[model samples]
Target chain A: MTSAPALVPRPLARARPLVEPALREAVDRLHPWLARIVGYSFGWCAADGSPSATPGGKGIRCALALLAAEAAGGAARDAVPAAVAVELVHGFSLVHDDIMDGDELRRSRPTVWKAYGTGPAVLAGDAMLTVAMATAARTGSRAALGELVGALDWLVRGQAEDLAFESRAFTGPDAVTVEEYLAMASGKTGALLGCAAAMGAALAGARGEAVTAYRDFGRHLGVAFQAIDDVLSVFGDPHRTGKPAGGDLTSGKKTLPVLEALAASTPASSRLARLLLERPLAEGQLTEAALLIDRAGGRRRTEAWAHIHHQRALHALHSAAPLPCPKADLTEVAAHLLHRTA
Target chain B: MTSAPALVPRPLARARPLVEPALREAVDRLHPWLARIVGYSFGWCAADGSPSATPGGKGIRCALALLAAEAAGGAARDAVPAAVAVELVHGFSLVHDDIMDGDELRRSRPTVWKAYGTGPAVLAGDAMLTVAMATAARTGSRAALGELVGALDWLVRGQAEDLAFESRAFTGPDAVTVEEYLAMASGKTGALLGCAAAMGAALAGARGEAVTAYRDFGRHLGVAFQAIDDVLSVFGDPHRTGKPAGGDLTSGKKTLPVLEALAASTPASSRLARLLLERPLAEGQLTEAALLIDRAGGRRRTEAWAHIHHQRALHALHSAAPLPCPKADLTEVAAHLLHRTA
Candidate 1:
């Protein structure tokens, strides 16, 4: 069942003032050029180092961290470093992801690799990764660095598989399976989100079952988030997505719905598979392909599939949420992620 | 004053059997293909995943880490995690360095990026970096991770400036000065080495002053090591170097000798200056550049410069060598680094 919407405080908005300022302060200490690159990546500065008020990511992951802390019966203020660390790590992955996937735009702006040359972009990502661990260290927990770095391995593994899947999706007879897609999504999206929540809870001194449940909640939410993202990538309103229509279909990324549609035995699936194998989908082919995907029930299947994960996430969130902890806002956060346009 | 050579035990040889296997065990836990890339990068496997012993480095850094543990009166076994962590970090840097510099050969074999495509290599390096931090966390010390992650920031900053220097050296009139070169070297080479020693000592329960002294010893040794490496890059016998002659010069790397010669005003230095700005070295220009570097006293000056750092390392080692701890093997490791031909 859908959880009740947040009636009072907005969790992410509350976390932003603390999270954003701390993130800016942390990266500000990087080397001059690195600081400039970070400033650009985070929407604080333009390419020429001038101020730019480009709104960055909604800090959803950052909010997950702080909310996890508050939901474990701790003050949100106590988890500021944890919030900073996860956001930095998320930015690190985004910077490197753009380079690896050869994507040109992120959040309606040029990717770091596109705006800067590959060398600078890659190194800048590396600096961010290093800074993430360093920032986490200030949390004074033996487990904070371990949890974040451990999540990174899963994240990288997921990315590696994602890259490998692109070449195999249409050609290889033994293409990646739906189960493999779920595993990859779990690692790529869910692992870091899980770490973000766990780090926040651990730093708040919420040990044992509370930590595990929070981590599970984040992971399932992440997979559900990935499924929703896949659905939107194909059918989203560009005005809301801040991206051109059919970006993922054009990029040939092996998102879950596409894989599911490809695996179907329907005639529309046959057309979609043929179109995928034909390489560059011709001009109007994208619109036709989207219709074919819908006809093959890919969109419905992915959306329905997401609800399973959403239910699991809610289950985990409720199971371990102590009565004293503030979870109303967390439930609202989850609902927003599920209902967001972009 | 040169410390007497090891008459008691071989430092690196004794440390290798301990370091190598632990490294293997560490990466063995990474994702499937990621493990294979790591195996190839570490020279434990060929491109096809078949076993191959192409000979990794001398494990000099690894030995330094383990020896630091012994020097702090801890069992060598107690520092295996630290040793593995440092070596993994070193390999992580090497993998990324090859990609960044587009070098094909490492230890006389194909670089990771060359053998595996850039995408897999980059992700593999990311995996290695993740594992390095995770393995360090097993030491049960929050300080271990903090120290290691801090050193990584310095290392990345050093590499960034080193790349920046390459462009400035040939394009701008204000080429990198000796002090700037030294600072970069300290960050690039000294920082990780310093971290290694500090991690080992800290793991062994060595507190405050002892750890600082150990860190200083490693940093000084790293600079000296860098200087000697510059000398060998230009002048060492190819058979010993395991690299084609003048590779660094042809690659236009701003090594110490080249930087020193560029700053000199002698006829040979003047000729060298013109040669460097003329773009990529022409046929036989590498040989000529080598001679010009020598004529400008770059070889002598760099060697003498190394000796000063060498003295500082020895002084630090002696001052910090506790009575209960072993020193003979540590002294040998020092002499070996200072005097090795390759």
Candidate 2:
């Protein structure tokens, strides 16, 4: 759990050149050729229910997976299936989570349920989950299946807890802190990413401590990614992030920035908290809440936290560097993830 | 597939006499000892969440699972885990299906969603599903896992189709026939049972034709059981069935009896269909609809169909009987299932 150094050699930075093409090819190959309904919903095709050439997301999970495998001294080909599976599951979770959270926007477009309706979205997510398990099963290794299932279990458990939290009214503004929020995020977001990395390593035949190191690296990196995301939710540029600033604030989400602001706020900031939580925020209130978090130094605090975890992730990668694998690719992948803006 | 004959002794039925007690004991042992807030919505526990001696239903799925193993010439001990897994998955499906179908009463008691909230009910069902998969995984062998996953895939697919059928405003009064309904039922119910038998056989080293026979027996029996239940839904005495007369009619559910009635009915049956489909049926309309189905000979036809499946199942049992297992217990189980009043 120790943090990595703030600076390291950039030998793996060249991974950026290969990451996108490799990821797109892997995902395209894994895409279901038969079920058009599912294939369309996956955003590989157009919303008009026709096949299209649009690629989805940044493919961060797949990158991490491939890198982890290579870091474990295995070929990227060996890890491609696991990488694809992770991406599918991650997308599935996002689609379903959007439905549950009532968010209408994803990838700067209408959410799955918004476009296809709730039932289809649910079914699509279920299909994705099934495909993920099916993919793992087809890989035919008990240990690999075990890793996948374990990751999924944690992911679902985290989601269940988050949903439970959202459904209830929190009594006080500062009922939970940034640390507690991190725990939730660890499960909700970090676990899957960690699993993606660990599973890649596992598929590559990395056993014992190397597997643990890869998993820990992903876990720490996931936390950092989420922490950065929380910061972006409040302070990032809308054009770059593809989301309106203070979107989470308007939705009354108790993300790290909001939680940190609540803890650090004075009585004046209480007014902002009340405005955010008393009811749905108006457009003007969203701006006010974002400003309040800024004034309270919540944005800076979250950024600092993200940086710490990012460093720790890289450090874990370094520790795992000596485990007899090609360390360059994984090291580059970890750095790219830490530095990602979206 | 041709239906099997009626007089051949089923191995599941014959083995049941010896395995029933042991199966019950195994279930008892497997039941969580914590006395926690489990099985509350299942109505197998009281408000305080304490286990009730007479809480669970007839446990038909459990019996079939054990019988399948025994019929496959596997010892009950080896098959008990598979049996338990099948039953758990069955229960999980029931809980979720009730929620999706908006069913309030199951087995004459409030459904999980009605007893608890939707969240708890969903969670409970999910927990059961997780347990089922985990149990299957623990049972070991690639074949067992494959069978379990295949059954699960069919089960979920059947449910997705059922939900799709129900979500539409007009599911066509006679759009689907008895055969289609039976196919749905087979996927929704029979697949797991077949898997149970197959898994048991696999565990027992019942290879090739013996395994196929056991699976066939279980599948036919499952279809027969459902057909009988459908008949009971319409024509059987409410008190004996432990459900309201014409419950399916009231729900506008496309059961075999109603489908058969609609298919055979002339202009006279149109009124019944309208009554069932226009809106939720009133108590008076329910009675009128039931009488109309009787007048249309739907009741007799459905009963005859059930009898045919029952005979088929019996024949399948006979075909599976040469696998070197006790005949008495399997025969008893088959009789108990085919002849059950509720």
Fraction of native contacts (fnat) of each candidate: 0.57, 0.04
lDDT against true structure, model 1: 0.82
Which pairs clash inside model 1?
A: none
Model 2 TM: 0.82
Q: Candidate 2 residues B99-215, lDDT tens each? A: 667777776677776776554555455555555665666666677677777777767666665655554332265376667677777777777777777777767666667667766
Best by TM-score: 1
Best model number under DockQ: 1
Task: Kindly report which residue stretches of model 1 are placed more than 4 angstroms away from their true locations once superposed.
Answer: A1-9, A170-173, A323-325, B1-9, B170-173, B323-325
Candidate 1: tens digits of C-alpha lDDT, residues B1-342? 244243424777778898888899989988878899999988899988999978787787788788888889887877788889889988899888777787888778888888988767878888888899888777778667767987898899899888788677542567788888888888898888888888888888888788888888888988998998898999887787777788888888888988787677788888998897665787588889999999998888888878898899888888776534457777777778878776
Task: Please report, as a residue range, the 10-residue window in candidate 2 chain A with the lowest summed lDDT.
Answer: A26-35
Residues forming the 10-long window of minimal summed lDDT in candidate 1 chain A: A1-10
